[model samples]
Each structure stands twice: as structure tokens, then as C-alpha cells.
Target: MIGVSVIGAGFWARQMHLPALAQLPGVRITSVVATSPESAQRAAAPYDEAQALTDIAEAAADPDTHVLDIVAPPDVHLPAVEIAAAHGKHAICIKPLARDLDEADRMLEAVDEAGTRLFYAENVPFIPALQEARQLVDAGDIGTVFRVKACEGIGEPHSPWFFDPDRSGGGAILDMAVHSLEFCRFFAKAPITAVYAEAGTFVHHDRTTAEDTAVLTLRFANGVIGQCEDSWSLQGAMDSRFEVFGTEGRILVDNLHRQPLQVVNARAGWSYPMPIAGLVADGHLAMLGHFLDCLRSGAPSLSDGHVGRDVLAVVDAAYRSVASGRREEIKETTR
Candidate 1:
């Protein structure tokens, strides 16, 4: 069996990762790690063999832990991944890989030196509708794609850390926009050259220091104009949409609005907190399946560390553009 250490006893771990783990046969949850034993134990309660621990190093160093499944916030990702790599363990780090470029670089370096895989847990590509959309765009059904737009909006995140810049690294841009930004890259399939962003804490000033609303413009090498809007002031409703404009035809996707069949398995701990939770759940499972396949076959992952770093670079560039009040070049980010 492939032993797994899920290193966060939070919402994502309980609601998202655990149910997915239940469906997979060969993997076992060896540990549930958290900042406190109570949280860890609460999260690990369903799995009989899972050990509750506060020390991440102990979990990573375990002989049975082949992978450290990190579901923590952006702040803990690097340290958790670093510890995993130090013990020669593969890791699955969730979206928005780092706060900045240097941290992303160190993550890549550690994994490279350890000769282990760092699977970036970016699930947007695994969305069923988006996958079909990508296929059509690639097959020339949309002719030469030129303009891409994507947006994801939510009222507020369940956790307070998302509002805490010290924990989350950035606001709506880094949190929700990363999804849309990665989707933009997914459609463009080219290097982003420059990015301009307008972001501020428009509504949630009392809640967070980070921006609650933002828009990002991306200039791709292939001349694709990619724009992303992410927001947290949508009241209680959630909205997600993607549009691709092309010479011959156009494709538009609204993933959250409707679905033919939806499920809410309370016993399974899979509840529909967000309107798109069903789709997101499927994406999470599909993404995990792909990573497990990579682990077993010793193959490359579609959303690997390199891809994560690339996305982070764009995010970093967006923040820079906000600071400079001009389009920032991704290549100039090193300076």
C-alpha cells in the first residue's frame, strides 16, 4: 500500500482530501498532522490507522509515508514540502505554490536535490467541462484563439487565515485568481510575457489587509490576451465563468451555474457548501488519480512543480504591476 500523510487537519483535508482517499484502494492515510493534537485527531478520526501528530518532521520521516499530502495554506506549503523532500518523500502541494519567486525556487531545488516528485495540486485542468473546452480549442473548433477570460468569485472563505496576509500570502488575487490565472494559461498554452493588475481591499477592509477584488491582464507570447477577475464580495453566491474568443467560433463555460446530476453525501463528508462543490470534488478526485498514476508509473505530472512556479511567477508579476502601476514583465521579475 502507498502510505500517505495528509499534513493539515482543516476544511480541505476533511471535506476534500479524505473522501477522495476513501475512494482510492491502494493508498492509506498514515498520519493526520496539524498545529494541535485535537485538530489532528478530529481530522484523523475516520481512518483507523491514521496517527495524529503535531510534528510534521515525524510524519515525513516515517518509513511508510511515501507522500506528504499538504492541504495547508500557502505559508506552510514550503516548510511541509521541504521536510517531505528532506526525507526523500514525494509531495502534493495545493494551488498558489508560493508567496514569491524565491520560495518557489527553493521548493523546486529541494525536490530536485532529493530526486523526488513535487506534484502541484492544481485541479482546474481536471474539470470535465473545462477539459472538453480545451479539447475543442486545441482541435481548431474555435479557430485561432486570441482572447481568454476567466473569473472565480466567492463571498468569503471558511478560514480566517485566508484574510490574514501573514498566512495566505495574498488576497483574492492569490486565492481565487490563481484558479482563473492558471485556467488562462491552460487555454493560451504559451508563456506569459507581461501582466498588469488592479487590486485593492475594496469591500473586506475590516476583514483583511489583502485585496478583496482584483483584475489581471496577461500578455501571452502567442499574442493571446488573457484576463482574470477574482472577487470575495459576491455576498453568499459564487460565480465562475470562462470564455474563449476566436476567429472562427467561440466557447463559453459557466461551471457553477448548472449540472445535470449533483450529489451531496453527508455520510461521506462531502457537502455542497459552495454551488460548485460537486464539480470541484470531481476535479480533486481526478487530479489525485492523475498524480497517483504518475507515482506508480514514474511519469511526469501535468501540473508539476515547474508549472506551479510558472503560475506563481505570473501572480508575483501581477502584484508587482499593482505596486508599479504599469505592466510588469515576467522575465524582469528576478530583478
Candidate 2:
């Protein structure tokens, strides 16, 4: 069994990772590190035999901890990973790995030098709906995927740092685009050749320096085209929709509003509390389970740091395209 040190007690940490990790076999959270000692303690209250602390160094240095699961913000990711590397612990980090390519390179270098098993925590491709869609595509139900359009638009995030460019990278594009960018690559099985993007702060203009909305056109090396849309201004429920067009057929998976179990009431109005989409479908458990399996059997996660870097590379080009007002060629990375 791999003992896990969970870094960050934020929303994703509490709502997703912790709950999922709690149920997975062969993995146990030994420690919890958060923004504050109190927060860490609060986060650890549900888990038996788990210690709480404010310092990642302490968590990583713990002999009982074999894996460092980082659910921290974008800015803190590399530093946490560095601690994990220094301690020679296996790591699973959330996506948009670093602020930029340089930071990502440094983190990759550190982990490589330490020989740490680093896995990028990207759960989009692991979602049941998306997995089924991929299976169909792989089986030639969609003969040759020529075009893909993926969109994720939700209201403002729960955290304040999500609005800051320096802390969270770019706004909607950086926060939500990573999902579509990575999943598009997964579906197409091709590297992005170029990207053209347009973004603006129509909403939340006064609230943040980053763009609140963005649309990117991605050209794959294998002649497939991808359209990615991201926004933080959508009203009401979130939109997690994808449309893939192939030579023989088409597939659409509206993951956001796919409510397998719905409820209606005169007092409370119609609602779907337990939506069968995204992490609610146990994607996080599947991801963590896969990582633990990798740790035990010497396999590799489907979404590793290299895959995360490549997706970031596309986002990097998209930001450049936003500035240049033209299609930007994706820079080749050695990793």
C-alpha cells in the first residue's frame, strides 16, 4: 500500500481527491497539509490515523508517506513537487502543472533528477462519459476524427486566486482550457501544430486582469482540427459539452447537465444534486486508483507530467495567439 500525503485542503482537495482517495484500495492518506494549520487539521478530521500540518516539507519528509498528492493552486504546484522530489516520494499533481513552460521544465528536471514517479492529475479523460466516447472512437464508430469542439464554461470559481493571473496563470483559458486541450489531444492522438485564439474580459473586467472568456482554434499535426472554448461568465449551470465529427459519424457528450438521477419539487424547484458528470462520476477515484496501480506495478499514468507539459505548450501558444492576433506555431519541447 502507498501512503499518501495530501497537499492542499481546498475545494478540489475536500470535495474530490480526499473523498475518492478515502475509498481507493492500496492507498491511504497519512498526512494532510493545507494553507493553514487549522485548515489542515479540519481537513484531516475525517480520516483515521491522519496527521495534519501546514508545511509540505513536513508532509513529504514523513517516512510513512510514499506518495505526495498535490491539489494546491497553480503557483504552489512546483514548490510542492520540489519537496516531493527532494524526499523521493511519488507525486500526483493537478493540471496546468506550472505557471509557464520554464517553471514546468524546472519541476520536470527536479523530479527526473530525483527519480520520483510524477503523475499529472488530469481527470477529464478519466470521466466515464468521455471514456465511453473514446472507446467508440477507438473502435472506428467514428471512423477518422477530423474535427473536435470542446467547451467548458462555468460561473466564477470558488477561490479568489482563480481571478489572479500571477497566482492561477491566465484566467478562463488557463483554468478551464487545460481540460479541453488535454482531452482533445487524447481524442485526436495528435500533437497540436498551431493555435489561433481570441480572448477578452467582457465580464469580470473590473474583478481580474486575466481574460474571462476565450476561444481557441487548434490545428493538429495529423490534420485534425479542434475548437476549444473557455469562460468564467456563464450563468446558471456549467456547460461541459463536446462534439466530435469524423468521416463516418459524429459523437456528442454533454457531460455537464447529464443528470442520471434528477429530482423535482414545488418548494425547492427542479435540481440534479448528484450529476453523473466529471468528478461526481468517481473520475477522481479512477485517477487516484490508476496512479496507485502505477506505483505498485511499475506502470505509468495515462496523463503524466509530459502530457501535462504538452497541453500547457498549446495553452502557451494560445496566449501568444491572443496577443499576436494570428495563429501561433506551437513551440517544440524536448520532453
Candidate 3:
């Protein structure tokens, strides 16, 4: 079994990742590390075999830990990564890899220097509805794809750290737009050239100076334009959807709304809701399972730390665009 130590004990760690990790075969939940012993134990309570540790250094030094699964807050990601590299352990880091590009580069560099893999644990690509849309586009169901759009909006996040600029990066755009950007990049199948964005603190002014809602226009190398929208101030249902348009047709995938499970295949001429597992659970399960399989097979994952860094480049530009009130150029990065 590939022994894994999880480096967080927060909501995502408990509700999403830990449960998914338990369900994966050939993976052992060796430890759960948190800022405190109590938090670690609480997060690991469901797993009988998981030991609780209060610090990443202690968990990284443990010989049984072959991999460090990092689901910590954005600010702590770099430290956990450095520790994992120091211990020569592979890692699985969640999305928005770092608060910024410079930090993300360090995270990527450390793992690369150690010759250890850091799989970017982004579940958006593995979402069942989005995957179905991509397959149809690839199979020529949507011929010569040209335009794409992805949006995710929900009421304020559960944690307060999310609204803090220093800890969680740039609020809704960074936290939620990262998801839309991933799927948009997936469908475009090309490098993003430029980003035009607009965002402001429309709500939660009392909570943060950060933007609660944002929109991005992504220009892809393949001549396709993609749109990404994110909001923490959304007052309605948690609306998330993906739209892929091509010369021949369009494919629409909707998740978390009145017709949440609907996948409208323009080529097949169908718009029907199909029952599946819950969105959050299914996404984490597929992504973590894919990473576990890659661990044993020695295969490169679809979203490596470099890919996360690349996405951050867009995010970096988007924030700049928001500030400058002009379209920002995306600096080329090593992806």
C-alpha cells in the first residue's frame, strides 16, 4: 500500500478528501497532520488507522509516509510542500496551488529538485458532467470547438480565511474561478494568451476588501475565447455550468441547480437529467483515485504542479486586469 499522510484537518480535508482517500484501494491513511492535536484527531476520527500529528515536519519525517496529501489553506501550502520535498515524499496539493505565482514556482521547484511528483489535486477535470462534455467534443460530436464558458457561484464560503487576502489569495476569482478556468482550459486544449477581467467587492464589504464576484475573458492560443465567472455573493441556487460551442454544435453541462444533473448533448439531441453520486463526493473520489493509480503506475498526472502554476498565471493576470481596468497579458510560464 502507498502510505499517505494528509496535511490538513479542515472542512475540505474532513468532508471531501479523507473520505475519498479511505475509499481508494492501495492507499493507506497513515497520518493526519494539523495545527493542533485536537484538530488532527478530529479530522482523522473516521479512519481507524490514521495517526494524528500536530505539525507537517513531524508527519513528513515519519518513515511510513510515502506521500503527503496537502489540503491545507493557501498560505501554508508552500511550507508543507517544502517539508514534503525535504523528506523525499511525493505530494498531492489542491487547487490554486499557491497564493501567487512566485510562491507557486517555489513549490514546483522544490518538488522538481527532489525528483518527486506533485499532482495538482484539481477535481474540476474529473467531474462526471464536464468529462462527458469533453468526450463528446473530442469524438467530433462538436466539430472544431471554438468557444467555451464555465461559471460557478455560491453564497459566501464557510470559512473566514477565504475572504482574507493574505491567507486565501484573491477571494472568489482565485477560489472559485480556478475551477472554471481549469475546465475552460481543458475544453480549449490550448495555452491561454491573455485575460480581460472585472471584479469588485459587491457584497461582504464588512467581511473583506477582496472581490466577492468576478468575470474573466480568456483568449486561448487555438483562437477560442473562454469566459469564466465566479461569485461568493450569489443569492440564488448554487449555479454552476459549462458550455462548449463548435462549428457543428454545442454541449451544455450543468451541475448544482434545479436541473443540476442535466447534460445537454447538442449532437445527440438530448437534454436529460441522469442520477449520479453527489458532486463533491464524486469529484474528489475520481481525482484522488486517479492520483493513487498514477502513484503505482509511475504515470504523469493530468494536472501537475506546473499546470496549477500555469492556471495561477491567468489568475495573476486577472487580478491585475481587475486593478488596471484593462486587459492584462499572461506571462508565459513553464507548464
Candidate 4:
């Protein structure tokens, strides 16, 4: 069994990671680390077998801990990842990866230099509906994907940390649009070459630097065009949806947090109600299980640090395009 230690026992940590780890086999929660003793205590309350600590170094140095799960805030991801790599432990880090591409590259470099495995905890692809959509596209149910569109927004916004650009990276682009970007990448099966974006603070006016809404258009390497609409402030309820158009047909998935896959074809019109089995109670568990499996089998991680770095590159380019009022090319990194 692989022993895991979790850092930053916050809402996501408690509600997602801890519970998911509890349900998985061949994994043990060896330690729970938080910014403070009280935070760690509160975060660890649900896991009776885990110990709460405030120092990541202490947790990483623990002999029993084979993996380090960093579910901390975006700002702390780099430091936590570095500490984990320093201690020679495999890591699973929640996304946007880092505040910027430079930090993301550094984190990946550290892990590579340590000869440690790194898994990026990106759940959007692992979601059953999205998975099915990918399968359909790959099967040529939609022949020659040419265009893609996706959106993710919440009617209600929470957490002051999310509103701060310095803390959360950017606004909707980094926070919500990343999911849509991943979806487009998954369905298109091509690298994004360029992006043009626009952003504004439609709501949450109190924040000065961060935006509340944004729209991005992407040019993929294979000549596919894609667009993503993301917002932290909208009319009603959380909404996430995607549609991919190809030469033969189209595939769409809507209300990703709650709904299933839907497909439409030129010959058949529409196929509704595609049955999907939920992957896991908590996505963190789904991702964690995969990480443990990789560690056990010496398999390569699906969402490796390089993938995280690539996503961060796209996000960075989007933000630059927003600022410069021109399309920006995504720069590929060797790391």
C-alpha cells in the first residue's frame, strides 16, 4: 500500500481529497498538513487515522508517506511541490499548476531532477461525460473535428481568495476557463497554437486587478478553431457545457457537473441520454487512485507536470492576448 500525505486541508481537501482517499484501497492517509495547527485539526477531523501537522517538510519527511498530495491554494502549490520533491516523494497537485508558467516549469524541473513522479489533479477529463465525449470523437463518430466550444460559469461566487488575481492566478481564465480549455484539447486532440481573448470585471467590482468574466478564441495546430466562455458571475446556477463539430457529425456534453453526453449526426439527427457510470464520489479520489496506481506499476502519469505546464502556457497566452489586444502564440517548453 502506498502511504499518502495531504497538504492544505481546506474545503477541497476535506470534502474531496480526504474522503476520496478514505474510500480507495491500497492507500493510506499518513499525514494531513495545513497552514496552521487549528486548520490542520479541523481538516483532519473526519480522518481518524491521519495525523494533523502544520509543516509540509515534517509530513514529507515522514518515512511512511510515499506520496504527497498538494491541495493547497494556488499560491502555495510551488513551495509544497518543491518540498515534496526534495523529500523524494511522488506528488499529485491540483491545477492551474501555478500562478504563472515560469513557476510551473520550475516545479516540473524540481520533480524531474529528483527523479520523482508528478501527477496533475485535473478532474475535468476524468468526468464520465467528458470521457464519453472524447471516446465518441476518437471513434470518428464525429469525423474530422473542425470546431469546438465550451463554457463554465457560476451564478453565485464565493471565496475572497478566488477574486484575488495574486492568489488565484487570474479570474475566470485561470479559475474556470481551464476546464473548457482541457475539454477542447481533449476533443480536438491537437495542441493550441494561438489565442485571442477579452476580459472584464462585470461583477465582483470590489476587486481591482481580476476579471469576473472572459472569452477566449483558440487556433489549434490541426486547423481547428475553438472558443471558451468563462465567468465567475452569471445569472443562475453553475453551468458547464461543450460541443465539438466535425465533418461527419457533432458531439456535445452539457451541465457537466450533473448531466451526460449528447450526440447529433447528419443522418440520425440526435442521440440523447447516453448512460454514464459516475467515476468517483469525489474527483480527487479518482485522480488519487490513478496516482497510486502509477506509483505501484511505475506507469507514466496521465496528467503529468508537462501537461500542467502546457495548460499554464495556454492560460498565460490568453491573459497576454487580453492585455495586448492581439493574438498570442503558445510557446512550447522542453521541460
- Model 3, 314-335: lDDT tens digits are 9999999998999999988965
List TM-scores for all candidates, in order.
0.92, 0.95, 0.93, 0.90
Candidate with top TM-score is 2
Ten-residue region with minimum lDDT total, candidate 2 = 274-283
RMSD of 2: 2.5
Q: lDDT of all predictions, in order shown?
A: 0.86, 0.86, 0.87, 0.82
Report, for all candidates in order, the number of backbone clashes: 0, 0, 0, 0
* Native-to-model Cα distance after best TM-score fit, residue 220 in candidate 2, in Å: 0.3
Error of 4 at 4 (Å): 1.1
Name the candidate, 2 or 4, with the larger TM-score value. 2
Which lDDT tens digits does candidate 4 get at residues 262-294?
455565444344243233622455677777888
Candidate 4 wrongly placed segments (more than 4 Å): 256-283
Query: After superposition, which runs of candidate 1 have C-alpha atoms over 4 Å from their true positions?
Result: 259-282, 332-335
Kindly report which residue stretches of model 3 are placed more than 4 angstroms away from their true locations once superposed: 257-276, 279-282
Identify the runs in model 2 with alpha carbons over 4 angstroms from their true place. 260-272, 275-282
Ranking by TM-score: 2, 3, 1, 4
